[model samples]
Target: DIAHQNKREIYNLLMRASADAVIRIAADPKHLGARVGVTSVLHTWGSAMTHHPHVHMIVPGGGLSEDGTKWIACRKNFFLSVRVLSRLYRRLILDGLSRLHKAGKLRFFGDHAKLADLAVFDAFLQPLRKIDWVVYAKEPFAGPKAVLAYLSRYTHRVAISNSRLIRVDDRGVTFRVKDYRITGPGRHTTMTLKTDEFIRRFLIHVLPKGQHRIRHYGFFGNGNRTANIARIRELLGAETPVPGLAHDNTIEDADAPARVLALPCPCCGGRLIIVDTFAPAQHPRAPPASARAAA
Candidate 1:
């Protein structure tokens, strides 16, 4: 409910706190003690289309020294402490929320009517400080292909994908969802929700107009990214990339036919089958055999 009323403010708070915490912790002598940069993307929906807002950041394994003389790499196979990040993130966000309330930028409605009072709001944030905010860091990508695959799956994903939708009938809307609490074969499951409830949950993630979901900070910031990357390459004595040529994992053949990613089906968890292919703006001659049989 709070997120619904203050979507823009809440998202902005998330971005600011995440970037700030990473930069601050990395600069500490106990940590990396260098100036680092990160690219952050905001995702507002969980697998079930719930309003679970969080930022996904991609940080280089190392950073430039404070004096900008050389690059400083983190210890192999590890990064900064997640505990330090969680605590600092909590403080920064709570502080931002207080400022918003004091500035009258935040709105309270429904059962939260009492939050308009300063004392009530302060009490509301009290419990949050004690609880550990989740700050996870996954293992580094295996290679460029893995990095590209991760970005392709998540960066622009919506609240839900049509491929996950199984059926819509008198039973309401049915879709596949991952139950993270469970493990092994029983983890994947299907859920059915009333039509109105499904729509309501989906709508909860729509952002306010003009809000940017992706952001970059520090050395990779928009104003100076090119210059910084060039300088870093020079310092490392690496060969410069060819001008106007973007690096990618695919074979460098412009005439080769494009192929779709082999993603598995959500319903049966089976590998994708290529029945047919079509060009841009052109429709397939007919439905696939399986879809035709299903219909």
Candidate 2:
């Protein structure tokens, strides 16, 4: 509830702090005074449908020079150093939180009500400065289509998807969950919870009304994005291509074979043919085709 109430400020701080870190790092003379752009999306749920807030930032591999005369590209397989990013992000966020607390812009209730006291709030944030905050960066997308696909999957997703729901009855709601602790076939499992409990979990993701989850920064920001992009493309000596789907099919084809390997029995190392498909809330029982097939 507190998170939902303060969603706007939290999201804004996250976006600003992260973008500032990138901009500061890129502007260093060693990086050739490059100006980078970032697009960030706020995600508030984990894989098991729990409240875990994080931001996913999509950044171009490099940036244009400060004078907009040359393009500065990052070295192969690396963006900014994660260590540097993490330290800067941690400091920036903690500082912002402190200022907000001092200004009485933050609200605290329930167990955190004690944080309303200035001293307690300062103490609470003091330890955070010594800890390393997580700031992850992934490999660049294959093309614009991959970027589109990623945005589609992540931007507006709720806590749980309809396909994962198995059943809803008086007893509870059952759903399939991926147990990430175990690898391979053993990872899939089912969990059931009361209807009210299910709703409670889902509602944890409800953002504050009118809060914008997607934000753009640097050259992609709203203020002068048009002029900035034009300058960048001109510097790179390339015009913006027509907006269309990426023609590369190799990215999609790479994952196609996983379906064929799905039915392997982990214990017996044998194939398990589907005898019957179970409806929602019911688990499928597929016996191995050959008993004791493994040596």
Candidate 3:
């Protein structure tokens, strides 16, 4: 609710704090002692189109030395400590929220109106400071192909997809949703909401104007990203990466073309064959406004 009310401030704070947490922790000699780069993408909606704001980050396992002379690599099969990251992230976000409240940048409404008062707002944030905020770091991707595959899922996803829309009528807008609590096939279910409510939920994810959903930090930052990447590649002796690292089997290869019936039919377990193709029909135009009003 707070995030929806103050989308820009809250999301900006999340990005800043998350990036700061990783950079600070990794910079410490006890951890990795290097300046790592981070690419973060902000997502505001969950599977059911609920307002669940989160950031996904992709960080390389190593970084350049402080003096810019050598590369510092992390221990095998280990990155930074989750506990350390969680603690630091919690502090940074809470501190940032406090600053926002003090600067009168935050808003409160309806039942939460009392939070406008300093005491009330501090009380609200007290429990958050005590409890650990989760900052889960999954195992590193297997290779560049795995990294590309993982990033493809979230980098450009929307609140909902057309394929999930089951129906739309006077009853409501029925759509498919996944219940994360369920363990198996039973997790998939359908949900229906009034058209007005559906629009309201969808609009919650539309970011404030000019607010970028994806941002890069450190070496991947905009100003000198290309040069920084080239330097890093030179240092790692990977200036020329292997063809397999860049290969994606999902795309057709021009040199070695695939068979016409290489792909299987979606509905049947048979090879798909190309048939005849035709131009698409144009959609009918809507009646004039005068006619619509008269009707």
Candidate 4:
């Protein structure tokens, strides 16, 4: 359990590394050689409420050219090659794990105790290099609204939504799950698990304290996003029908309120404003040093 507890860190590292790899590949002179933007959201559960960590990234169909004077559009119905992305993603994650292991940042216990040994750890990671990892990319959304709607569904989701829950009686917990193996209506099925097992599975998906499940990268990064985006807009030309394009405003900029108000309020169709700020609750203390070392 202690070893598995750091999965949130692993997930974050994997996604960030994979995104960097994608950007590097996409920016290759032979490929696109343009600056791209990506918004990645981490999902840690499957329909069966199992620990199935993955990232959903939204990337524009094109990017700004390296010269910052032109826009580069990708080929129709295609982005980066998934096969290349998968291979790179696998390597990055495995290498990251190896580094963590060597740094004594990773813990091991119970069935995974052998991984504490350097030889065993190396052996454990060796097999991963041979297998293909999944790194998928879909076609661009219809519009900015479509992208926002899609993000809203996943950005805040938990292991299992209330709508999927059928019952939680003394015997166990029941929920509806989509059996992707079958097609159409037949894929929908109900599953029941012992109460303890259900809770255990759900708890595994709970992220580490203060961990951000959503992250932006490349041109979308917080530091230079404003300037980079403004250049992209200029390259695309004012006549282009890019939805939701507006003036750039850095967090330090005085025009930050204008940026905040740009988002429409869902309740009354007015504007969202930051009326107050508060510090986050303190996280519970970790296991004792001796307890952790024992694991």
Instruction: Give me the candidate number with maximum TM-score.
Output: 1
Residue lDDT tens for model 1, 1-295: 6766799998999899999999999999899998899989899987798888899998988898888899988998888999999999999999999999999999999899899999999999999989989799998889766776676666667789899999999979999999888989998999999999999999888889998877999889999899888888988897798754445422345675753345554433344566778899997786446966867
Candidate 4 regions with alpha-carbon error over 4 angstroms: 1-3, 238-295
Cα TM-score of candidate 4: 0.78
Report the number of clashing residue pairs per model: 0, 0, 0, 0
Q: Write the per-residue lDDT of candidate 2 for residues 1-295, one digit (tens) a residue.
A: 4455577787778778988988888778765368888888888876667777778889888887777777788888887888887898898998999888878788887888988899998988888888878787888889876886777677766788888998988899999888767999879989898888888888888888887888898888899898888887887777575544323321344657632323434333234565577799987765666867532
Clashing pairs in 2: none
Instruction: Encode model 3's per-residue lDDT on 1-295: one tens digit a residue.
Output: 7787899999999999999999999999999999889999999998889999999999999988887677899988788999999999999999999999999999989988899999999999999998868898988899886886677677878899899999999988999999988989899999999999999999999999999988999878899787777788889888555543423233355776642225534433244565544457956555557966857
Regions of model 1 farther than 4 Å from truth? 246-295
Model 1 residue-pair collision total = 0
Model 3 residue runs over 4 Å out of place are 240-295
Ranking by lDDT: 3, 1, 4, 2
User: What does candidate 4's lDDT look like per residue over 1-295, in tens digits?
Assistant: 4336577558777677878878887898777678889888888788998777778888888887877778888888888888877787787888888888888888777788887999988987788799878776777788877887787787777888889999999989999999877998889999999999998999988788888988999889999998887788777765444456444321345856544325545533334565555567956555558966858
TM-score of each: 0.83, 0.77, 0.81, 0.78
Error of 1 at 77 (Å): 1.4
Global local distance difference test of model 1:
0.86
Better of 1 and 3 by TM-score: 1
Model 1: per-residue Cα lDDT at residue 48: 90
Q: Which residue pairs clash in candidate 3?
A: none
Mark the 10 consecutive residues where model 2 has the least summed lDDT.
243-252
lDDT of 1 at 278: 88
